[model samples]
Target: ICNTVYRRIPLRGVCTKCGGNLTLTVHERSIKKYLEISKMLTEKYDLPGYARQRIKLVEKSIESLFTNDKVKVTKLSDFL
Candidate 1:
């Protein structure tokens, strides 16, 4: 699963999972949105246990998508 996700990332460019082109800013926003949703789902709300578990997977995927860089220009895939 990690291999598939890693391969899906462009080496030095931006593209959606479907190979659709995306601006760097757009991709960053998309990832941030997912991260927020996952965080909310994990909170002690009215959500089911299973739902929170699934959202954790989404969070993990987002983690793999990028590195710990403050500036988002250097993609993690570039080091792959």
Candidate 2:
């Protein structure tokens, strides 16, 4: 009996009914694109060449998820 709000479900529309910190948009293209960008950025910063940059990259990616203005989507595919 997981409440949709607590379950990390994609946002059903533009407004967040819960008014929580993270607002997810229910759109596949947006979510997929975010994942792809996160992955590519992760790989770039996680490489041996950028050993010191791993932390930076990871932080950036996480922040991007919340701060990205291009699209709003929280990755809930793991649950799907």
Candidate 3:
């Protein structure tokens, strides 16, 4: 799914007119879809140190990519 959407995107960048946002969203979703399961499996099995580190690196990269750092709070009262 990610490959198909990625292929459709032009070399320059994502084009919003051609569902670029949707394409990127789908690609990210597909990439993260199996992340949890992979983590679980790694924990369940006695994988090598290198393998565990690789998964942790991937998780951190994905989180950094998808995380919004500049969120604005609209209403402090809402939280309380």
Candidate 4:
């Protein structure tokens, strides 16, 4: 997916809006693929403390990467 996106990118190195969205979706899916299974296995197998900690770190990193950083505000009257 990334390779395809890279090829489609312009020489200036900026991806088109579509390409950027595709790349983000691909990355998000791939990152989340094994997360649940990894945590389940870690618990089932009684993995070492470090291994568990590493998985937690990865989860945090993934969350940060995929989460929207922007904050949106609405007028208080809108809720009335």
Candidate 5:
């Protein structure tokens, strides 16, 4: 049984008759975007020749909330 209520999806559901490719949809695009931006920001904002691994660890938190399209994030606060 799948519960979309809590956005709970089983990774792979077994088929009754014959087991087949049961793919689980994950939010991979978000992951990619976060990884890309963190790299860009850490380089630009932080000190030169700094610890990249540490930067990545710090970036994980910021990535969680940065979901909107980049332009859209800037536009909403402009409403007056």
Candidate 6:
């Protein structure tokens, strides 16, 4: 499941189950925008709950980027 989610999140031009090709450029841009929004929120607000969720999401996005590049993470915990 981790591997599947890893692949789905980051890699561009991967094949879909229905034989279609998936691309990451658009998705990456979208995630980046969300990250920026999250960052801005963090800067402007003191809401711990909202900040925590955004932080987790940004971390996941970073993890996906690293995984997409075939970085050899020794353990899932390390990735986390």
The TM-score leader among the candidates is: 4
Model 3, range 26-62, lDDT digits (tens) per residue? 4678888789888888889978888899999999999
Clashes of each: 0, 0, 0, 0, 0, 0
Q: Estimate, for each residue in 1-80, the C-alpha lDDT of model 4 and write its tens digit.
A: 23444535465444554444343235787768799889999999999999999999999999988787796567999999
TM-score of each: 0.41, 0.28, 0.54, 0.56, 0.35, 0.38
Provide the overall lDDT of each model, using Cα atoms, as 2-decimal numbers: 0.64, 0.57, 0.74, 0.75, 0.58, 0.61
Ranking by TM-score: 4, 3, 1, 6, 5, 2
Highest lDDT among the candidates is held by which one? 4
Candidate order (lDDT): 4, 3, 1, 6, 5, 2
Once fitted onto the true fold, the runs of candidate 6 whose alpha carbons sit more than 4 angstroms away are 1-25, 65-67, 71-80
Error of 6 at 52 (Å): 2.7
Superposed by TM-score, candidate 3 places the C-alpha of residue 40 at a distance from the truth, in angstroms, of 1.5
lDDT-wise, the better of 3 and 5 is 3
The residue pairs that clash in candidate 6, if any, are none
Judged by TM-score relative to the true structure, which candidate is superior, 1 or 3?
Answer: 3
lDDT of 3 at 26: 48
Residue 54 lDDT in model 3?
96
Residue range 1-80, candidate 2, lDDT tens digits? 22235445455542255544544456555555765675576687765656447555755665666675977666889569
Candidate 3 positional error at 3, Å: 19
Q: Please give the range of 10 consecutive residues that has the lowest summed lDDT in model 3.
A: 16-25
lDDT at position 55, candidate 6:
89
Kindly list the per-residue Cα lDDT of model 6 for residues 1-80, writing each as its tens digit.
11232334434444434435444344566566777787777778866786678687777867578466655549878879
1-80 in candidate 5: lDDT tens per residue? 33233245344555333454344555657667767786887778875655687766656655654555555544666985
